[model samples]
Structures are given as structure tokens and as C-alpha cells.
Target: MGSIFGTDGIRGIYGDDKVNEDMAFRLGKAFVQFLKRSSDHPEVIVGRDTRISGERLQKEMARGIIVGGGRAFISPIITTPGLSYLVHANRADGGVMITASHNPPQYNGFKFFNSGGEKLSRSEETVLENLLSDTDPDRGLKIREEAVYLKEATESYVRFLLSTIPKDMDFRGIFIILDCANGATSSVASELFSRLNIVHGLINCAGDGENINRGCGALYPDSLKEYVLHLKAVAGFSFDGDGDRVVAVDERGDVIDGDQILIIASRLLKERGILKNNLVVSTIMSNMGLMDALRDMGLRHIECDVGDRNVYETMKAHGAVLGGEESGHIIFREHHVTGDGLLTSLQILFAMKYFNLPLSKMSKWMVPFPRVMLNVGVKKRPEINSVAAIRKVIEDAKKDLLNKGRVLVRYSGTEPVCRVMVEGKDRKRIDAWANKIADVIRLNLN
Candidate 1:
């Protein structure tokens, strides 16, 4: 009964009260109703990741769309970005992607996109939320007819990806590992890499509908590090369940986070004169090292809030072409409206090709300061500034760190947890401070 939409989307364990088939149907109908204001007969593109609940939910949503006097086209298995592309390419009214991104397999959700392939803005989401609440579940019987499936969606997406990279650019000698996380990118990645003639191996590519993000992918890039070393590959890329984010592993089995990826891509784009405004936008969660590296390269840097949507909005305001989060959501504004993992991977590879350097070398520009992050489960989410004890501890830690480091205390938008991040020149000091803050939060909130 709480607000269904989170920072990303509506997410919870499948079959739960909120994420059940009934909610899916209602959401579909609500979305169509919202779209009808612009178009009399609205059309929607629907896609899902490889979760067991996806097909059932898709059918329910299709039924709702039909009953709502709209047309539905289903791209049964596709990445979030792929669905975004198809929405714009086909000129649909809107689109819906059924996924939970990097959340565990049991979690599933809906991500809405407008006609321009951008995630629904906060104001648009609010409209949809109002519609969702007003939808009547018993307004119509379920329609047995399912949404029309787009069989060519995957192929078209691959071709579009190829168009992003130069046709003459050679990828023959680059051996890389791809961890699909057994999600939406499993078969799509195989086909794309094969077409490009890139020598690559895949891990966690076989999804039984239950293994997506199960001990693999961006959430666990270290899981792919050994495979990179064993294959003697130049680098490895691990994508989240829905393929909107990615984390890279270098040849030395070191994890190259989004900060490092942004640094590498920004430098290449700047040299090519494609970096508009010579600016980069990252989230507050980004390492200080990334900001320092940008300064050293004489590139303007800005910090936004924690979400990728916030980063993109900030990028738009500043006319910056590159923006991302430390959690691996990198948006190359020149290529697409939202984050695309495959496109980002290609950008990284393009950077490698442009510099004639290996990822291990390119990733060395930023030396992250010693940092510690602790997540504390909470029974309630109270304002951090409102809690006197918690506020006092955070203020005390800030004073102690002084000019050397900083402390950030915030709640996870998608989960019921408080995250405490402390960074400083001294690791031990930061670690102790982080623990102190986390313990205080737990005492007050739990």
C-alpha cells in the first residue's frame, strides 16, 4: 500500500501482494490510460528479463492493455536498453521493461519509458502512480489473447549496436570474457560478439529463469576476474540482470568500476572532440579519486544525487555527454537516452583501440582513496538530519576527518537499509568511523 515506485521502479519479490499478477495487470492498464491522453489508440512495447515470473506477468499486462483499448507488442526477452531502442525505433507511445536490474532473481519490477526512449520522468511517474491507484481490477475479464511478440527485436537491437561502432574497426585480437548474469543479455551478447568477430567467452549465460544475478555479474565482478586471467583475455565485462549497468575486470584480475570506466571513456571522447562542454557528471557516491583525475585532465566535473536518473537529468541541464554512477550505470548521452551496458562496453573497447592500450593500463589513472561502506538493515526510514544522536555522530565524524576525507550517510532508495560511506587518507580511521556511524543508525532506526 506504500508508494509502489522506488528510485528505479516498483520492485519486490514476485507473487508478493505488491508484485503479483493483479498489480501487473493494473499497471498495464494504468500506463495505457495515461498514454491515451496523447493518442487515441496507444501502442506499448513490453519486454522482460529471464525471470520465471516474467511470462506470466507479461500475459497479464497484455490482457490489461487490450482491455484498456490499446495495442501491446511484447519483446519477450530483451535488455532494458533494447526495449528502450525498440520503443523509439517503432515510434510507440510508451514502453515497459519487466525487471529488477541487479536485484536477486526473486525480485521483479516494471520500468517505464516514454516515446523518446527515456525512463519516465518523476512527474510522469507520478501521473502513472495516480492512474495505477485508480484502476479497477474487476473492470474487465482477462483476455486470453497475448500481446503480439516482436520476433525481430533481438536482431534489430544487435544491428543497431553494430551501427554504433565503426564497421571497419577491427576486433580480431581482443579476447574478452562476458558475464551475462544469465539474464536478458545471454543470447543477445553471444550473437552481437560473434557478428563483430570478437574472440570472447561467456559465463552465466544459461538462464533457467532462476539464476539471473545469482553470484555473478556487476554485483560480483570479482566472480569474473579469475575467468579473465584463465582465458588470458585483455579484460572482462559483467552486466547486471537487465543489462543497464556494467562492471569491467582487467587482465590483472582487478575490478574496474564505473568511476574508472568513466575516466577512460571521457579522456577518449575529449581527444576525439566528442566530449561536449569538456564535462563529466558523476554521483555523490563516486570516489574522490575520479574527481581528482578529471581535474588533472582539465575536464569539468559535477556531482549529482545517487540515482542514474538524477545523473542523466543533471547531464541534460549542463549539456554534458557523459554521466554515470559508481554502482555501474554509465550513460553516454551521445549514443542513447538511458544507460546501455553493451554500448558502454563498446565505448571502453573503443577507448582501448584509440589509445592502443590494455584496460589494466587505462584504468590506472585514478587511485581511489581508502573508503569503507557499511549497510545497516533498518525497520524504518527516518530523516538522518532529524535524528539528534545520528546527526551528532555524523557531524563529529565530519569534524574529525576535516580536510582529509568525508562521510556520507544516506538511505538506499530501493531497499530498506541505511548506507554509511566514509573515505579518508587513512583506511583504519575511515573504517572505524564508518562502523561507528552504522552502529548508531542501527540503534536509532532498528
Candidate 2:
């Protein structure tokens, strides 16, 4: 058997070699067995996105859970963080979320959370994978024919979301736009907004399975930006397919990404004297502007690798309450165990109201340096240090930038490409340097 978990979880194209029903079944069984090692009668809360393959995967996993002598409760069509919340809220042994998270419709996967609503650590995943190797698929384990569905799971999650905001707060004059990415949030975003009496407009809330993330959501916020401008709303938010990520557009139609969001939120939290240790955690992908802004506010930040799990671990170690990725996975440790798009959106709104400032004005506190990024397709991902030519190019670029900027070159964890990022005071100079690095990578690796 090979490793099943990725930086997030097990993900692949549906019906593909790694993500078929059989694999899902085996994983389900393995997960339950691993849980049973500690608890005799384990229970799991299962949820999924709006992908067409989600239902089938959920069924197979649930079947395995039941066969392994564990109870499986299905929470249909919920966000990833919603599932995480349910696991901790209900004290289930674990939780499984079926989603590919901003991927195309053809792709689907699983993200597992512990009873604490936190993602499984690397060692935990290793233990589960080891169990998968010992399980016998043909052992004639009796599979349950029916699944127990949780009807009030969505409502419970919504109440939790509302509880995070103060009751006296209102959104009567605040008009905002939302692009649901035609995925899991579509089923709940409107209800949550209505319950809060928020004046909001929505787009891309209709999901046809295949239409989810098709030029919408966080990956493509241009349409959402246009809609925000048209409505002249105070702000706009676009959530990814699984509702784990978000990208925003300000009143001035300028995009505010996760880094900016982190800065803004950090400032607010610091004002309230709740920013733990006065530290914020961000990934390597975060912009230098965020660091500058944090410094200007007399706050500090630490850099982790490019995953929320990594960010969470670092945040925990350092007693930081806030952390996020540039791609919009913002984790507020005080309120959520995982990155939540809905929660992040609400927090941004609360910040806007508390500061009594438009997003455009708040966003101006951080002026991002000019940066150029190029994704070079590669036949294989080689260790950067081992490739002498690539190393030389990277070092040369760093030397040229000196103290004025930075250069980051890393292989994409999920794709066959090398990302070369150059940030500097001059856009043209950085673009040239970035292309120079990309050319070296393509020439040597591709």
C-alpha cells in the first residue's frame, strides 16, 4: 500500500486509480479500526460537498465505518469546517469531509478531522495508513445497508456561526455580495444571511455539480468583483467549493486576499487585546506587505509551510490565535479548529463595522509590493538544492534583490509545476528575474 493522505487529505479525480469507491471503503474501515484502538465503540460524522461523486464516496466510507463496528452519521452537503465543527460539538470519534476544495468538478477527496475538530497529525495519518495495509478486503465483513443521517447538523452549525457574532450587531445598511462557488455553501449561506437580517446579494449560488468552481469562487473572483462594483456593495466575498477558502473584493473593487484579511483581522484582534502573544501566523506564500503591516501595528508574524495544518501546528506551538494562507484559508483558533470561509467572511464584516471604515480604506494600511509569479510545468519535481543550475539561478536572483525584496521557488505540492515568485520594488525588474528563474527550471526539469 502507498500513502493515501496529502497535505490536506486523500484527493484525486473521481473513478481514478487513487480515489475509487474501493479505496474509499478501505479508508473508512481503516479509520474506524484506528479509532477503535482507543474507543471500543467509535462513531463518525460524515459530510460532503456538492460534487456528484461526493454521494458515492460518502456511501462507501459509511459502509466501511459500519462494517468496522462503528456508527456513521451522515450530514449531507455541508462545508468542510462545518463537518469539523460537528465532530467537536458532538464529540464524535472523528469526522470525514468529501471535497476537493476549489478543484474542478471532476475531482473529489476526503479530509479527516479528529474528535477535537483538528485535522489528523502526520503521525495519526501514518497510523491509519498502516491499518489500511493490514485490513483484508475480502474478509466478508458485513456492511450496513442503511446510514444514519443527521438532520439538524446544518442548523447547529448555523447557530454556532451566529453565536460568534455579538447579538447587538446589525447589518441593516451594510450591503455585501457573495459568490458561493456553486458548491456546499450554496445550501446554507442564504439561510445564515437571512437569519442575521443582513442586506446582501448573491451570485454563483446555483450548483449543477459540474458547474461548481467553473470560473467562479475564490479562484476566479473577477466576476464577483464586477458584481460588487455594480451593486456598490460595501464588500464582496467568494467562497471556494468546499467553503474552506475565500477571496474578497473591497468597495473600490480591489481584491483583498487572505494575507490582507489576516492583517486586518489581526489589527482588530490586537485592538481588543485578544491577539495571543501578539503574534499572527502565515505561510511562506504570504505577501511581504502583510508582514510590513503587522510590523507597523507593532505586531509580529511567523512563517510556516504552505498548508493550514502546518500553520495550525505552528500557531498552537507559539500560542497564536490567528493564522492563514494567502489563498484564503484563514483559521481563527479561538472560534474554529479549521479554516472556515463563512466564519472569515463574518469576521471581516464585523471588523468593517467595528472600525467604521470601508474595506478599501482598511485595506490601504497594507500596500503590497510588486510581485511576479510564474508556474513552470515540469516533468518531475527535483530537489532545488540538488539541481545546481536551478540553485545558481535562485541564489543569483536573491543576491540581486538583496534587502529590497525576496525570491521564493518551490514545487507545488499538488501539481507538476514549480512556482517561482519574485517580489521587489520594481515590477518590471522582478518580472524579468522571475522569468529568468522559470526559464532555468523549464530548461533543466522539463
Candidate 3:
């Protein structure tokens, strides 16, 4: 039940024994030591978001890295995308990002990257856990002292961003607003819009470590929805705490999820004749309309478990060009291996420019069906994956939802609960189906 790594990486509420400096130091030492044993003088990069404990963890981690005979470069409070950029641009041996993503302020985690700037492979993680649990610092590792060269990553990151996108993006006629989520995308999005000559406004642009995602991020799109209407902006976008996911506010202030974003991006890619194998990877959480969009264009879909990494792995397995979560961690296989919210925003903007269409019009390609989702809390979750009782409920729900709707029930990966979802053309049916499944799971799985 206890592992250092969680859904993302090493995560726990701050000031807790599980995610303290000692564990941070051990994790750092384990990585550097493992790298040294595998090669000589492995250089790496470490970056963090604007969390209060970020600085202390950075120092302790870096010391462990240097002590284990590796060079560690420090990047001050940049978005998660920025760290990925540094890993590729600087060609570091590895990278570590300190973030808990959309988790509360009191929680923090460390995400490890391999030499390729992607998440650590399962094998690598297993090795690191072994080393962390058993290794002693004083006698087993070599030591050194190195300076942390603080990097202004956004400047270079933005330029790299600009080059990947088209030259003449004229959103002048479109008034767009952006919600920075009081996290990492605060500065970059504003500057990107101005340089593109795209007329836009912004909110929650400054992040106090304590203020991040405090009622103002992708998870809280209502804030941006209100802003979109207040400013009468053409559209608005929201970035998560680490700026890896984007949620948008339409002209009508309707919140747009990644399914719609995927539909738009996939259509654009298909138009450009760059979509690989005419395929996309999405989770079961994707809207039903997305399937219709794919069907209309004769494109296929590969469904994976609900996670960006799972989607990425599916993309790699099927040789698909694109994949992402409902949240906004869209990945374009051609550009980068992992999710980049900045990249996703640019892709959407580029699509709008190419089509010379409004965000609302672009969204028309896929008509989203109503979806109902709820989390059922219980004392403890039992094995419901293949239980006959849960299977019967699923079978009955599937039969009832045939041809017009669907049902999905799974334990929450990040929380102590189970998720029930029902999607269909009818809201009442969706709600009833969702609640019925929830009731069954609560009675048995719970």
C-alpha cells in the first residue's frame, strides 16, 4: 500500500514524514548514484514550480546529486514544460521537476525524467526505490561542490515555442482572455500573446506560492468562464498549477475540455496531412462526441486508462501521432514526448488561424454529449475490478445504455474513492445511469 511513487511521482502532504527533506535527499542521491554506476559524470537539470517548499527541496536534492558525483543545474520556478525544454535544449543527462500539480498547497512531489526528457520508465523507478531504501550517504557515494546557475528559462522556452508555430497568426480580430491559474504559465502566456500580435487580456497572472490553483485554474474554470463574459473576449484558456494542462473558456463562456481540444487539433492535423495513421489516443473519459468526430473523418481511436502517461504509452504502442487526457495534457508525438500545455495552446491558436474561424465555430466540429460524473466515498475500497457483483452492474448498465450512451466505473487513482461516469445525449438518462452505478459500487466495492 505504501510506495514512494504515487500516480505522478513522490507525493505527500508537506511537513509530513513521507515527503520531507530526508526522503528528497535520498531520492536525489539514488538517481545520481545510479547514473554514475551506469556512466561517468552524468550531468542533470532540476527545476521547480512556485511552491514555498520548492527552494529547500531543491537545495537538499542538489546536494545529494553533487555528493553522488553528478552535476545538477538549477532552474528557478519555471513551468513543467520549461523543465522539459531545458532537458532537450541543454541536453542534460536527466531532469527532476518538483511539483504536486493540481494538488493542494500543502502537498508536493518530485517527477523524474530520463535521459530523453521523458518520465522515468518503470524499470528506472524500481531501481531508484531500491537504492533509496538501502543506500547510506557517507560511505557509498562520492561527493563534490557545484554552483547552481539560475536560468531564465522562459525567454529561451518562448523562442523555441514561437519557432514551432506558424509565423502569421492573426488573432487581432479575436479578443482572447487567459487565466494563468496563479501558477507557472502566468508570464509566458501573456508574452506569447503580445509577441504574436494576438489581442488578448489576462487574469491571475501572478502566482504567490500560496495562491496557486486557489480557485483559479483548469480545475476551476468557472473563474475564467466569468472573465470571458466580463471582458467579452473571444475565448479564454486556463493552465494548471504546473502549467501542463489547459482548459478553455469559449466566447459564450462555455468551458471546453480536452475532448473538444483533441477534436479540433486532430481535425487540423488531418487537414495538414500530418496525422499519423489517422489515429488518436484518448481515455474512456473522453466525450462521446469525440468518437463521432473520429468516425466522420474515418479516423480511429485507441482508448487507454485515465492518465496522460497511459495515453502516451498507448500512443507509442500504436504509433499514433497524438494523445491526451480530458484534463489537458495533450501530447503531439512529432514535437515532444510528454505533455506541454504551452505547446497545446499554440496548436489551438494555429488551428484557429489556419481555418480563419472563431473558437466557437472550430468547436462545432464535435458536438459534445452531456456527461455526468461523481465520486463515491466509502470506508475502504474492495476488489471490484472483476467481482461478479460489480460486473453484473456494469453489464446491466451497458445493456441499458446501448447505442446511445455508456457507463464507466473505476477506483480513483489519486484519491480514496471510486469514480462513476455516464454519458449520453440525454442529461437525465446520464445522471440516472451514473447514480445507479454509483449506488451499486457503494453497496459492494465500498
Candidate 4:
């Protein structure tokens, strides 16, 4: 009954309250009930990442949908964005993706998308929550039908992604590397690059379910960086568990985060005269340098809250085609409604080819200010401003930066942690300051 959905969706350790089979089943019935308000026998697309629990959750949800008089089309082992695309492409009423994204293997959840392939707005989520509170998992336990399985789901997504790139662009002789995070993309990334004639190596592409995001992926780009340098490849990319985020590595082995990727892609779009309004949308979590870089290029920058959904909504409101978070949730609105890690990589590749430059050269436009982030585990989340000790430390850290740096304190929407970020010219100072803020949060919240 209580709102279980976090910033993204209902996420927690699998088998825990709110993420178990019963919740997934009830949520599915609720989703069906909500969709039936507009259409009878609403069709829903269901997909999941490589988590071991994904299959179980998908089956339970499908069972609920069947009993609720809804049609469920289940895709085999697909990424979150892939599922979103299918929802839009298939013209389904809506979709659900079983994933916890970058969270560890034990964590799993669902991301729901509307028919337009956008994440559900807060109001829509509320409708589902209310419906969930009313629905009983066992009340309509008779399954009338089995969910339909789409065997070509991954193939459809791959084909659509390939189509987004230019037809004539040559990728021959481009040696690249990919770290699939042993997650959703593991099954499709290699096939994608191979079709494009890209000479590539894949690491962490084998998922045993438990190995997804175990130590590789966008969350740990160092492994990809090392592989990129060791192979002397032109570039590399690391994707998160759900394949909605990416962290790139260049030939020089320098990690290119979402901010740099945004700068690079924005410049390319501007050069191609396709950048609408000359505007880029980024979250407040973006680096100060990214803002400066955008200004230097005479592009407009709008900062939103810390979520890709927030960035996308702001982008849509302003007619902006480019937006993302610094953590690698870049949304190329012109191509898709949601962020796709594989799509982003291709866009970056397109940028490189369009400019006739290597990944390192294409990414050198921005010099990120030194930023340090510390995450403190918390038992509960109160508004940061309402906590005097935490608020005072955050304000003092900002003041100490002398208008040159900034401090941001926020709780992780997906996890039980408080994130303290401090950025400035002085790395050591910001690092120490971030730790101080994190310590205060720990003392007060923990």
C-alpha cells in the first residue's frame, strides 16, 4: 500500500518486500487495471536483464497479466531500453523491464514505460500504486492464458539500433572494445558490432546471472580502461546491467564519462546542424566544467534533477534533443525516448567518424573540474536541508569553494545511501570536503 516505487521503480533486494514475486504479480495486475481504463485487453511488453531473479519475476508478472485479462508479450533476456523500444514499436499499451540497472547482482526491480516509451510520470506511478494497494495477488489466481514469447525481440532491437547510424559511414578497420557488464547487452553487443564490420573485442560479456556488475560495467570503468589500453584499440565502452548507461574509454585509456560524451555528441550535432535550439539538458550532478564547455561553444545548458527521466522530461519541455546525466544515462531524444547504452556508443562512434578523429581527439573538448563523491550507507532518508548537521556542512563546503566550486548532497534514488559531491579546482580540498560531508550524513542519518 505504501509507495514502493523509488525514483526509478520498485527496487530492493530480490525476495525482499516490494520486489518479490507477490509484489511483481500484484503490480502487473495493477498495471493491467490502469491500462484497461483506456483499452480492453491491453497488450503489455515484458523484458528483463540477466539477473537470476528476472525470469522468476517476469513469469509471476505474466501470470498476473493473464489473470487480469491482459496480453503480455515476453521478450527473452533483453535490455531495458530494448523493451521500451519494443513497447513503442509494437504499439503495446505499456511495458515493464525487470532490472536494478547498475545496482549489484542481489538487487532487482522493474522500470515501467508508457506506450510512448517514456518512463511513467509521478502521477501515473501513483495510479499504479493505488491500484496495487487494491489488487489482491490471489483474488484472480486463475491464469486464462500464457504470455506470448517474442523470439526475435533482441534481433528487432539490434536492427533498430543499426538503422540509427548512417548507412554509408565506414567502420572498417576500427578496432574497438566492449565491456558488456555481463548483463543484458552481453547477448547482443558482439553481434551488433560484428554486423557493422567493426573489429572488436568483448570482455565481461558472459553473464552467469550472479556475475552481472560483479566488478565490471559502467560502474567500474577502470577495467575497461585497462583493457582498452592493453589492446591498443581505438576506443572501448562499458555498459551497465540494464544497458541504459555507458562509460567510454578512449585509445589513451582515459575514461570518457557522460558529461564528456554529451559535450562530444552536442558538438557533433551542432556541426551537423541537427542540434535543436542549441540546447543540452543535464542534471545537477553534471560537472561544473560541462556547463563551462557548453557555454564556450555558445550552446545553452539546462540543469535538472538527478535522473535520466528528469533530463528527458526537461528536454521534451524545451524541445531539446540532447540530455543525460554525468553517470552515463545519455538520452538522444531524436533517436529514442529513453537512454540506450548501445545507441550512445554508436552515436559517439558516429561523432568520431563524422569529424574524422579518434575517440581521444573527439573527447578532449572539456576539462572536467576535479570532483569527488562519497556515498554513505543510511538507514533512512530525510530531506538533507531538514538535517541541520548535514545542511550546515554542505553549505559550508560550498562557501569554502569561493564561488569557484560547488557542493551537492542528495540521496541515491535507487539505493539506501547518501551521496556527497564536491567539485573545485583543488582535488584534495574537494576530496576532503566530500568526505567531511559524507561523515556528517553518516553520523546523523545512519
- The per-residue C-alpha lDDT of model 2 at residue 198 equals 86
Model 1: worst 10 consecutive residues (lDDT sum): 138-147
- List the pairs of residues colliding in candidate 1: none
- Considering only N, C-alpha and C atoms within 3 Å, which residue pairs clash in candidate 3? 175-234
For model 1, residues 1-446, the per-residue Cα lDDT tens digits are 56778888788899887687998889989999999989998899999999999888887877788788889999969999999999999999999999989999999999998888888888889999999888988635866456788999999999988888778889888899999999999969989988888889999999999999999989988779999998899989999999999999999999999999999988988999999999999999999899899999999999999888899899999999999998889998887888889999988888899899999999998888889999999999878999999999999999999999999999987788999999989999999999999999999998
Q: After aligning candidate 2 to the native by TM-score, how far in Å is the CA of 95 from where it should be? A: 0.6
Per-residue C-alpha lDDT of model 2 across residues 357-380, encoded as one tens digit per residue: 999988888889998988899997
Listed in order, each prediction's TM-score against the native is 0.98, 0.97, 0.93, 0.98
Query: Candidate 3 or 4, higher lDDT?
Result: 4
- Over 4 Å off, model 2: 139-141
| Descending-lDDT candidate ranking | 4, 1, 2, 3
RMSD of 3: 2.3
Model 2 TM: 0.97
lDDT of candidate model 3 versus the reference: 0.81
C-alpha-based local distance difference test score of model 2 = 0.90
Query: Number of clashing residue pairs in every model?
Result: 0, 0, 1, 0
Which pairs of residues have clashing backbones in candidate 4?
A: none
- Tens-place lDDT per residue, model 3, 57-146, is 877788778776788888877788778878878878888898888876777889888777778766777888888877564534445577
Residue 252 alpha-carbon offset, candidate 1, angstroms: 0.5
